[model samples]
Target chain A: MMTNPGNKVTQGQFSFLPDLTDEQISAQIKYALKNHWAVSVEYTDDPHPRNTYWEMYGNPMFDLKDPAGILLEVNNCRNALPNMYVRVTAFDSTKGWEAPRMSFIVNRPPNEPGFRLLRQERDGRSQGYSIVPYATDRPEGERS
Target chain B: MLDAIAKGTAAPDESVDLQAEFEASNIDEVMDKLDRELVGLKPIKTRIREIAALLLVDRLRRKFGLTSGAPTLHMNFTGNPGTGKTTVALRMAEILHRLGYVREGHMVAVTRDDLVGQYVGHTAPKTREVIKRAMGGVLFIDEAYYLYKPENERDYGQESIEILLQCMENNRDDLVVILAGYKNKMDRFFDSNPGMRSRIAHHLDFPDYGVSELKSIAEIMLGEQNYRLSEAAAKALEEYLPIRMRLPHFSNARSVRNGLDRARLRQANRLFASRNRVLTKTDLITIEESDIRGSRVFAEGKLEGEPETKAR
Candidate 1:
């Protein structure tokens, strides 16, 4: 139903809703811990949907029984890059469960300047569309 | 429209008439046009029909409250150039549209240059832009193997390939990507990139047109331009087709079309040289044997490539 050709980096679950509260985040971390899944936190200034390699907040808390440890790491990453996007991921090490099982963004910039859609008319009745994040218009690192 | 197909639930005893749904979709007209437009691709045609039938049946099943995962329509069109790959992709897009698989069936054709960028940060935006334009319908990527480059140390093509594979998997429901290129190169590409190979559902190999099919295609091309090849000219072309095929860069039907275009040019020049003579419409329209014979092809054997469009 979204008509704009622009792309928004809406990765992971519950992305369309508001940022999860600490209580909600704790509930999700607890659920992941219950399944014996390894919980990891990652943060990135370049949160492009295809930019899957986010900076890990230390090693994944493997074999950790407590959800409070992950919550601490998530907040730590958020404190370091308060204006950038941060996410918490759950991974299972069992055979055939190779990729991350679930992940969600828990931090976002206040303004969330979105992206600008660029269109160019090409030869032979062709058109090209691409998007640039609003923050990228400014210099690197200064982007919110 | 999608909701209409998704929401309807038939009673347990109700019958689903496939013929009625097929007629209502009006995809038969598109198939007929494909048959008329292309010279010969029997296997490809049958594959298209099979896919259409599959989609139609899938729609019918959905109507009966049957739950089946959406079928992956991403395809690989492997063949030589001028083998009607592009033409078939356009028709496939129409079929997808009529079947309600994609909203707008218009195809966006691109090659590696259109996607892979020269710089580190450039490839993502460029590839994403192309995907955005190609979101609703078909994205026909010709020479798709070029998106991956193991030889080039700092090439940004790998980045583009990663993004494309990601998009192809994540956006399967709305977008259909048809990767086309030389068959062997595509195989090698898949050999390196297993992710892409796994995602592709249909592999449509477009066989090269035979000499006879080339001749008929010439007639159709000439007819479209209101020009008819005289009997001798047709024979001249029959000779030309094989020679062209042997020479480097003989791109099947495209080469035939180009050869006819040259013949028409020569015919006009011959008519122009006989100045001060009133010419009949027949003379103007007819491509005489002499017109085609004048080509360097006759002076020299067709063993050599055309000097004008030589292979790189």
Candidate 2:
């Protein structure tokens, strides 16, 4: 055992996307990452009303692919929620690193918490809890 | 001597050359012409003049500054339906153009359906198209509340709103945007968007017309159509109108116009059966008491013939 307090597990500052170059999108992703928040992004090309959330990793880098199977690289890490699918198209990477290409699509589900919380609260209320006397006589802790 | 000279000249075609005189004037001409067509909107007229003056001043200011652009006057008109909001908006476009704020006095009225697109990517271009159409003149958005609905997370309405905010900011020097709807709903809409509330600086409220005003409006309409209401018939209409107008569904000016149209149809039917091809001066087309008393031509289950209830 070390003499110093060395076995501590420290939570790192959550960075959602640290590599995005576009300032607005980068800031938005940063905000989401900092707050453990989610964002709705149009992630598909079929023109469906679909959005997804991505779990933010160490540094957000997107592996983008186009309909033509061309890979584009996005290296800017910014804030993004887990499991969010962002609609993106592949583009050539500026870093010359064979990065996958993806274009910033319009954000959907503009408000993150509006519907989810309401649904959760409604479900909680519908599955109401029962109140019971917890070992009413608990035997006084078995008479100590 | 001058009185005799004026009177003896074949009564000087005493018809007064109303059209020629009315045409000679500018603002007053439009107002007078509209007065013959539209009735009993005294408050609206006053507000219209206020807006016209503002437009005139804005134009003068632009000229003084030697600017080639016009100033946009953002207004919010709140009232119930059929209170002549759209009519006033159309007239306002003409007045503003006459006052030299816009090159063309066209008014493009739109609903949410016109601006908001179904998909995410399509909304910006769609809204831009609407703004382009309304560039030179007034763009009137009716029932603006739908544009700020809280539901629909994938709301194309927000995209439209964002685009509209940008358009209003960018073209503040040229376009005039008027948002009109029920007062409470419009208040909610403004409350929803800070940008909208801040940009729309003028608010005009259109109050519902009373029975007397409605009657006057109806008489004006008849006068314009070359018909007159007999004294007893006018009185009966006044009394009958107050009662019918007190109903919740009854709309000002519009309701009165509808009632007059029904009465005219009834009179026409009666005249057709009486073998009268042309109406003589003495036998003028007049709205009669029986017309207001209700006839088979009037819709059934209506407030007609019912005990008159006072509007709250």
Candidate 3:
């Protein structure tokens, strides 16, 4: 199981996928529109396992209803920074919050370096394991 | 005008009921209190007015179909203890509520103890509960620097700070947070957590009250209670303040308040121990020089003072 190529960075709602397709992104946008949520695109160079906040490409798009319109923005973001990780986020204003309720990865770098598990030995001969992204362990420019 | 419309009375030129309602809810009274009630800290008062003006202008701009954005209402209050930080925070809540920036205008003050939990897996819910209570109002965190003690690895305060940072970003529309502490400690706090620093928009430094300002606070406190300080008593206070201020744990306004309380107690004791058969009205309400001079709380330099380095 550890050697499987299906190693994925489990983070937000749809982290199981390696990279979402254009059709899947469009479907998610449609769901957001049905729920009256605003869609936005965010990208980041350091997609560390613990990093939750990402820089938004622009403000949340409140007027767009068609998934194709959102796809254009997403594709543009992907093309602009092909090496960086990019994702689609949906913001909800319900329940007195302006939180990103749903987010999923749409694009990732070519060489997906996963995580490294660390082991710590205790005084009683017991051990502990900690998982951290291998990319963050290196310098920013050398992540890819 | 909206109130009039909702009342089903739309007379563009005049509406007496609407005018009265507007006058009642106007923030001018709250603003006037900030100017009148608090002593010194002119910069703090001015900063508050500037924020209020910005919010007001944003509202008007929105009405006119102009591009408007919500100003970051999170603030950092840096001052010594008893420097009117909490008072200003309360008045700020009232001002924001009147301006429709906040819903309730109430302030829930907390520290690390109230936000952080003692055990593992218990801090998030505790911090979230405080955030929920502070919703639609202001969350005033005193000695906020304690929320992050990098020296203590086992401490749960960092978890609480993380949760607070998240809420400060996600719930900016309805909630206003004010983190208050000494200038140096708060600076170090933001330094340790650079991400938390960027989220805060306003930084108001509450300067310590001068000797004269503390004296005036004392006079006001005594005057409000129908107690008059004699000429000699006032002189004693003026002299006492400068010396007390030089010592460690010199809380500006709070020390003055404590001094006044001690003077009042001494006056009561003096009256009861008097040889006169009957005490006159003047004797009952007057604070003599002896009353102000006799209390060694300031002279002893041990009036349950806050630590010079960290607030306890």
In terms of lDDT, which candidate is stronger, 1 or 2? 1
Which pairs, if any, clash in model 1?
Answer: A129-B129, A130-B129
Number of the top lDDT candidate = 1
Candidate 1 regions exceeding 4 Å error are: A1-144, B1-6, B302-312
**How do the residues A1-144 of candidate 3 rate in per-residue lDDT, one tens digit apiece?**
675475555567677755677878888887886787888889887767668788887455664434544665688789988877888888998888788878888887776677778899988999998877765776877755
Task: Rank the models by DockQ, top first.
Answer: 1, 3, 2
Worst 10 residues of 3 chain B by lDDT: B303-312
Model 1 local distance difference test score: 0.82
* Weakest lDDT window of 10 consecutive positions for candidate 1 chain A: A1-10
Window of ten residues with lowest summed lDDT in model 2 chain B: B12-21
- Regions of model 3 farther than 4 Å from truth: A1-144, B1-25, B297-312
Clash count of each predicted structure:
2, 37, 0
Which window of 10 residues has the lowest lDDT sum in candidate 1 chain B?
B303-312
Model 2 over residues A1-144: C-alpha lDDT tens digits?
Answer: 433243211111221323234445544443433333222233311112222333232222222111110111122121242222233332234556444333344222222221111122355466433332222223433411
lDDT of 2 by residue, B48-116 (tens): 767665655444333234344444478888987778889888987887767666545678899999999
